[model samples]
Target chain A: SQQGEEDPQALSIQEGENATMNCSYKTSINNLQWYRQNSGRGLVHLILIRSNEREKHSGRLRVTLDTSKKSSSLLITASRAADTASYFCATDETYFQGAQKLVFGQGTRLTINP
Target chain B: EAGVTQFPSHSVIEKGQTVTLRCDPISGHDNLYWYRRVMGKEIKFLLHFVKESKQDESGMPNNRFLAERTGGTYSTLKVQPAELEDSGVYFCASSPPGVTDTQYFGPGTRLTVL
Candidate 1:
């Protein structure tokens, strides 16, 4: 069974607008990370938030994690056409001995229209 | 500073045939992982290796799928007697030791079992 599930499987917005995607997980996690995949490309690391951290920001990306709700969100500000891609949220569950493997969620497809 | 790399970006084979996918993680990265995404489904973890030792393989679907990392450098995933349900994108990821939160991914191998 998949540990995380992303909400709003698809989202489309103007290039200058902001895009937000949400994810919910079933288990306790050591950390949560967001990744992006361009068409025909590999997944790219975006942002990571530890279970003890509430929010983090990197360039135009902001990520928030709520352990109480077992949910997370990724917000991309001032989206660009190049931001069009699939975003996935992955969880490193604490149950694993070393927490090496990551369980991923069905990605949210975001389209930034120019 | 070469990133993770996977060989044979795309593969097409008939059912019951064997296919081998290779992944070379970033140098010095001991944590190697394998994941796959069936069409329209979430990407699922297949296994993990730390320095040539299998750390966690709880997500492996079955015995037909074999993953190995020789010398703790590069890894390979072999699927024997591939089935139609096995067609999907196979991804390889690696994280630096002690850094389980972020993983670097390689261009995935798209396996199409006909």
Candidate 2:
């Protein structure tokens, strides 16, 4: 079973619109990180919010983590065509010997129209 | 600084054949991880190596898959007698010591089995 699941399997919006994607996890985590994967490319680290942090902002991206709800949301302001990609949320949990592994979600595929 | 790099961006092989994928992490990074994403499925963790030691491999699917990191540097994943279900994108990531939040990913190897 997957530990994290993202909402809205696909999304399409205009260039200037804001895009929001949500992720829900089943267990406690040390931190939740978001990544983007362009077509045929590697995953790019987006933003990470620790379990203790409620919200974080980087450039035009906003990420909020609600541990009580075990959910997180990523908001991309002023979307661009280049932002078209699959966004995934990964949960990092402490394993044996303090080593960690990330459990990823199915991801939300977003397309920004010009 | 160079980012993580993977060789053979794409590979096509028939079932019962062998395929090897390589990943070279950034300089001085000690933590390396492997992940896979099958068609229409979420990316899943395969294994993790900390300086040439198998820190965790709970997500590895089966015994046919072998991974090695010699001298705590570049790593290789070999699949012998590959099955049809083993076809997917193989991603390798690395994080620097003491930093678990961010991981640099390499452009994955897309494996296709006929």
Candidate 3:
């Protein structure tokens, strides 16, 4: 079952603009991670924000977590044409006994028009 | 360092045919995972392997799907008598044992069932 659900099923923006995606999950999690996938390629690990952490940043990417609301958001600043892809948020719903199955959300397809 | 690798970048088969997909994780990575994205839905977890053992397979769809990780170096997922609903992108990922929840993914295998 998919525990996380991403908003803005699709988004289109011009290059140099910022793209923000949001995800909402059902249960408590140890951490939240975001990923990106180019067309016909696998997902690439982005940044992770633990439940205890409210926000984190890597390069031009920023992630904010709100455990009280069971939601997380990813913001990509100064998006490039190459940044056109799908973004997914995964939550660690179960991390017991080494079974860390990441429950993913319905991704957001972001298109950066050049 | 080489990341996770999967064989047969794409496979097309008729319904009811059997297909076996392979995944070779990063060297010395004790954790291996299998996930699939079907149609336009979310990418979902299939199973998790710790070394050579099946640590978790709670998300496997049905008996037609079987996964094995012999020798703990590489893993294989087999679908017996595949159905049209089984068509999707199968991904393989690996992560080292640590506090990090980062998972490196492989170029997924695109499975088409007609």
Predicted complexes: DockQ each:
0.77, 0.78, 0.67
State the lDDT of candidate 2 residue by residue for B1-114, as single tens digits. 999999889999999999999999999999999999998689999999999999888888999999999999999999998999999999999999976558889999999999
- Each candidate's chain A: what TM-score? 0.94, 0.97, 0.95
**Pairs of colliding residues, candidate 1:** none
For model 2, residues A1-114, the per-residue Cα lDDT tens digits are: 437899988999999999999999998888999999999999999988999999999999999999999999999999999999999999986776777888899999999999
- Going through the candidates in the order shown, the clash numbers are 0, 0, 0
In candidate 1, stretches whose alpha carbon ends up further than 4 angstroms from where it belongs are none
Residue B19, candidate 2: Cα error in Å is 0.1
Candidate 3 wrongly placed segments (more than 4 Å)? B98-100
Candidate 3: how many backbone clashes? Answer: 0
C-alpha lDDT score of every prediction, in listed order = 0.91, 0.93, 0.91
Q: Name the DockQ score for candidate 3.
A: 0.67
Best by DockQ: 2
DockQ (model 1, Cα) = 0.77
| Model 3 Cα lDDT, one tens digit per residue, A8-30 | 99999999999999999988888
- Candidate 3 on B1-114: residue-level lDDT in tens? 999999879999999999999999999898999999999799998888888887788879999999999898999999998999999999999989652267889999999999
- Assess the local accuracy of residue A33 in candidate 1 as a C-alpha lDDT between 0 and 100: 90
Question: What's the CA error at residue A99 for candidate 3, in Å?
Answer: 3.1
> Which pairs of residues clash in candidate 2, taking residues 3 or more apart in a chain or in different chains?
none
- Candidate 2 lDDT score relative to the true structure: 0.93
Candidate 1 achieves a global lDDT of 0.91
